[model samples]
Target: MAVTFVLAFGGSVLAQEQWVEFSSPRDGFRITFPGTPGIEDVTWTSQMGYALPARVFTVDRGREHYSVTVADYRGIEKLGIAKSQSCAPGAETCIGGQTRIVGPGYWKSDVHGAITYAVFMLLRRHGTPTGMTWNWAEQVEGTLLQFTNADQSRTSASIYMHDNRLYVIEGDVPKGTPEPELFKMSIGFIRPDGSGSNIYSHRFRISAACAAATLSASDRAPASRRPPGRVSGARTFPASPITFRSMARLPTAARFSRTTGRCQSCGGAGSSR
Candidate 1:
């Protein structure tokens, strides 16, 4: 939920766009948002008249050895497979950062092979002439296991994403490549003070992730300015718009004080009118 806001507001969301490779930060090792591998390091330019995608939220770690990220693309959701595979995740398991089975589903992409497992998105191994691409959101809880068969693999790098951001967390686990092992989670952040932080350093990994949000009118603003998809994952949402109002745009000043029942949406996540 928090990450959703970061992307929508930080400048990534738009009417619907394509992926753009980020520049700068020189060069560094890339991990699958291992914490939440997704696309980042973007920038927003004012030359477009309106806010455009511009910033580097997609994080890479390890100091210039590799690159991993999460990318947003198109996909499909199937149901019958859930019956055959039988890994329906319940409410208790939805919390961020824990290990649970999602569905016996998979993410099939032309880039990577069929990364089958128990989750919503698939982490395809789509390597290009320059680098590799793996798309999936970061796991809040329940590790997302990506198993291989034997040794003799071609690529030495990878990436992943969850919610809406990508992460770089996994390393070349040569020892347990084929076996069913838990996927490693990580924590990366852009703090309120405009600083960067990776919550999941080499010492720790995320278990179950939880992000709270205010999901009301959203479309009126730039998509990125909103938040990540709903945490609850409701397929259907009310068709409304979230508008950004400027004080100067108002015809007259309608002033009031906090003590006199002023601002309407002023409280945090829990309070209400």
Candidate 2:
């Protein structure tokens, strides 16, 4: 999706700019930005105290700021193993018997708790959290937060974890402006082939291979026996009733309206289709 802006002066259109879709295959995600965004590589310290690699893609339109941060957690298990190996003999800080610095499946826990940790960091910002809720975009579960900044600017943020990568998306605009829902809604997970996961209605699932690598013996229990909200390696997600096949039959706007119960373009707050 694209947003076009035209500047008019004296009844004449002077200049135009477009918000174009930007895809980062390396980062495994895509989003729309007012222009090409600046990319920066940085080290991110996870809540579990592991130094992970991260990248930030940002674009500024006047006073408004938009950014998506991708933090890679793929190497966390290795880091945990190294920490455990480096622990002193009979160290009290080691968990799960004295042999490990961290518990079994600690990386999985870290990945699962990423969204909550990211949301906590956002809440710590110099802003008042006006609203927060569990939200899903393109079938990926996440948390969404609305904040009123100290300067009265409004900010909307969403955090999601997919494929062991944590995504933090934020948009801040001056007060009284409509929420930057377009930027927020445009987030899409990308495949290696450059196709977007958003093109289909499917829930994010951890593959059996990933489960084999990450799940500890205790985490391999039956889904019913496992604790609620715990990640299950073998669990299967039910297909969404609203499939792309059915949506393709409807008009574009009608499809979005059917899914959201509101106009996609206007971002209004009514149940009108």
- Top model by lDDT, which number? 2
Q: Candidate 2: where are CA atoms >4 Å away?
A: 1-17, 92-105, 198-273
Q: In model 2, what is the error at residue 209, expressed in angstroms?
A: 7.4
Q: Mind giving the per-residue lDDT tens digits that candidate 1 earns over 1-273?
A: 999888887564341222233322322222222233344554222111112232233322322112333322122123213322454455322221121122213211211221222122323442222233343333222233343324432223323323222333333333424321122323333333534433211111212210001122332335545433333243212121211111111122132122222223434321223
Per-model lDDT: 0.28, 0.65
lDDT per residue for candidate 2 within 143-250, as digits (tens), equals: 888999998999998888777788999999998888888998789898877887643222223234322322232244454553233222443322222222222222
Error of 2 at 10 (Å): 12
Report RMSD (Å) for each prediction in the order shown: 20.9, 15.2
CA lDDT of 105 in candidate 1? Answer: 33
